[model samples]
Target: MRVGKASDTDVEQVGTMREGKLDQKHLLFGEDDSPNNYDLNMGLTGGGGWRTPRHRHNFDQIRYVIQGELPYTETEVLKEGWVGYFPESVHYGPQERAEGLRTMVLQCGGASGQGYLSVARREAVNAELNKVGEFKKGLYHYTDANGVAQTKDGSEAIFEHATGGALRFAAPRYTDVIAMDPDAYDWHKSQDTGVEEKWLGRFTERDLRIGFLRLDAGAVYQAGQFNSIEILFQTKGRVTAGGTEYGPETGYEFLANEGPVQVEAVEPTEFLRMVLHTF
Candidate 1:
């Protein structure tokens, strides 16, 4: 089991085509070679807003809006407390935001068999690409080995070169975006004392699970041994686990067989729980 405080994590600034000047705090990063390997991060888009070109990833991604808003489609916007899921190779975006957009993002290998790449790793590749090409207006301009000027979609070019043309994979489990509002779900009391839960939805094709937990003040909750990777993001009030107190924006990750965990609510608290089963 691993717990982290948002205030304690370093904020990293990465400059790139898709990211712009956004700030990110990495909460968890899974092992590189494992299909279940994943990355969870909180991203903050500052005053000037953020924009990204239309593109697709080899992996799947889920974004939960924590604050502000971003447009998923010309007519659809993701506001606070909303969630959006993007499956592998499903193109969407030309993403844009006006100001103060904050989101928690989870990325993992898609059921399509394509691998996952960390933001850090992707940044490294971007840096290398910069030396040989230039990213401008959401496109990459380069002179290939044949010395011919070429142009390609920025994200497509980067992933292709980074994976050495091995980026293709089986079709994704879901081809369209999935969006939801957790607040719209009904809460169900847990068998555990003082704990109530709301199941958001499950993407069985990707072994993904999502839900919310609400714990009353001074209540204790016991977590059973998990058979998958579990991530908890504090959404309201305060909770203590493993001798550390966590408030909103803080998150924790527990691996399979990590055993039962004891969680205590220092105050009335609520959190979003996401799990990726190994099956």
Candidate 2:
């Protein structure tokens, strides 16, 4: 088990690999050797906001809007307090986010098991690619040996460069992005006293899940019951575990069948929880 406080994580400015100016706080990172390697991060859009072209990836992503709104496309927008599941191989976006938007995102390998490419590796390759080509407006512009100019998606370019092959996406399980409204789902009483749950959805054959958990003040809950990795991000209230106190924005990770960990609510608390894809 690992616990991460948002304040302890360093902030980084996004690179030119994408056409945007955003600050990112990477909170928790999984093992690089595993296909299920993942990164959980909080991103903030500054003054002019950020932009990403219409694109897709081989990995899955779950996004929750914490503040302001996210414009995923020119027409489709996710208002604050919304959750979206972006599955592998499904295209979305030409995003034009508004300033002061805050969002938390979890990026991981999907059911296809292609795995996730680390941001560190991507940035390193981007730097090398910059010497040979230029990234412009979410695309890479470069010249070929035949003396011809060509353009490729910047993300695809970096993946190919890093892996020494073309990036191939699996057949999409969902035709479009799945947008969810947590408020629309009613919380159900859990078997544990003083605990309630709202499970939004479960996806793919790998059984990736998205849900929320609530604990009343003074309630004690046993966590880490899932067959896969379980991650919890405090959305509100305070809790204590193993004599340590945790507040909002703090993250916790429990590995598969890692056994139970007791969490006692010092005050009424709510958490956004996810069970990563089973490998």
Candidate 3:
């Protein structure tokens, strides 16, 4: 098992930080197949300051709040530990005020050799119903071993049938992002599970496989026939991946180019895992 750690200074690309106003910590940027298009950044804003004017983009956007509160025009105001998903070809502009605004932003898909916003347009008073509709649809669902829908409302929250987490780099098109509560599970120490095991769920979409994983202390786990790149984010405790040892609040990534590697839990651990398979 290997792991990697991303430091505060390691992320310095400020996509839109105003002087003495706001700052962005890009955790994972320029990864996977969609190099020019993919971006995951954290934003922090100062008090008594205004955020960048509302704008639109050709690509999709997802914002997860790690702390504090921020408001969106169409969606409701989000506080700490909330996630907001914006679909491709939609408009999302925020007018927020806070002691400081902090958020994690993820972007996927590319078009016409353009980066981020294709054109710089003026900020507008967004229409109540911003866009006609969104390009993509809902999250993928699964039927449990009992043949009943594991997720009653949707797959965004807990999914009993989910085996392993899915990744956008693996199944770019079918990948749908979700915001979840970290304290949703009753986590136990690794020694509890006799054998080290992880279940990456079935493909929600043909090319997409997403789920969660838990490992016992010193338990080694691996996958066969992965045929796609996988991304894992440390959600609970600590673990090692890709020749690195990472603890909580760290992200580790691996390409299936070689073969499946050992994934072991140093302590008890959980991860937000996603594998994107080529069709």
Candidate 4:
């Protein structure tokens, strides 16, 4: 198990096809050189009128709004504390926010086995592509070897050309976006002592699991071994694990078969946990 605090992560500016000056703090990343690798990032938009072009990624993404509001559809908005899931190849936005926004985002491979590219890597590729092609209206435009003009989805082109042959074509896990308000859900007590959980959603095909856990002060929780990738993000109070104390915004990743992880609540604590099973 690996534990870390959000304040300990380095913050960097990562430009995207979006319209804002965005900075991000990386919380966790999957194993190196693995197609099944994933990334977790905390993003903060600086400008008041930030926006992103209508775009899609090669992998699936889950985002939780920590602050501010963002438009999800023509008639819908993702307010603070809401969560959203964007499946691979599913188009959704022209997302925008009138004020600054802060969110936690998770990007991982889809059920079809398509790989995910890190935002930093994608930014580097976009820089190179910018010299040869122009990204406009969410599409990349350039002349082919035959001098014929061509246009492609900005995200698709970036994935194909930037990482060479690392990515493969695959069917998206879902065709539409999923959003939820945790406050509207009920928390159920788990078998674990002093621990209560609220299951958000699970995608069996992708082996994706999302949920929240609440623990009483001085409670001890044991995370049993599993053939999967498990991640915990502290949202309220404090929790100590593996000799490290973590507060809100902190996160931890537990490896597969990593024996029971002991987590102690220094106070009444609440956190979000996500798992991606291998089976």
In order of listing, the candidates' clash counts read 0, 0, 27, 1
Q: What is candidate 2's TM-score against the reference?
A: 0.97
> TM-scores for all candidates?
0.92, 0.97, 0.55, 0.91
Model 2 over residues 1-279: C-alpha lDDT tens digits? 788888888889888877768999988988875778898999999888788899999999999999988877789877899999999999999998878999999999889989999889988999999999999989999999998999999999999999999999999999999999999999999988999999999999999999999999998878888999999988999999889998998888889988588888999999999999998
What tens digits encode model 1's per-residue C-alpha lDDT throughout 98-195? 66788899888776555687667678888999998898767889998899999888777777877787557566566667888887999988888899
lDDT tens digits by residue: candidate 4, 125-218? 8898889988765678999999999987777778778767644455655667888889998999887789999988988465678888899999
**Which digits, one per residue and each the tens of the lDDT, describe model 3 over residues 1-279?**
223344643544332222135565545544333423355555666656544334343344555566776666535465675555554334344454475666655554432222332111111101111232111112223455677653221111111112123211121332233334434534443333433323323432334444456776887656333565555556667666656677765654455554456767888876655554343
lDDT on C-alpha atoms for all candidate structures: 0.79, 0.91, 0.45, 0.78
Pitting candidate 2 against candidate 3, the one with the higher lDDT is: 2
Off by over 4 Å in 3: 1-4, 11-20, 31-37, 110-211, 221-227, 256-258, 275-279
Lowest-lDDT window of 10 residues in candidate 2? 28-37
RMSD of each: 1.9, 1.0, 14.9, 2.2
Q: What global local distance difference test value does model 1 have? A: 0.79
lDDT of 4: 0.78
Of the pair 3 and 4, which is ahead by lDDT? 4
Better of 1 and 3 by TM-score: 1
Q: By lDDT, rank the candidates, best first.
A: 2, 1, 4, 3
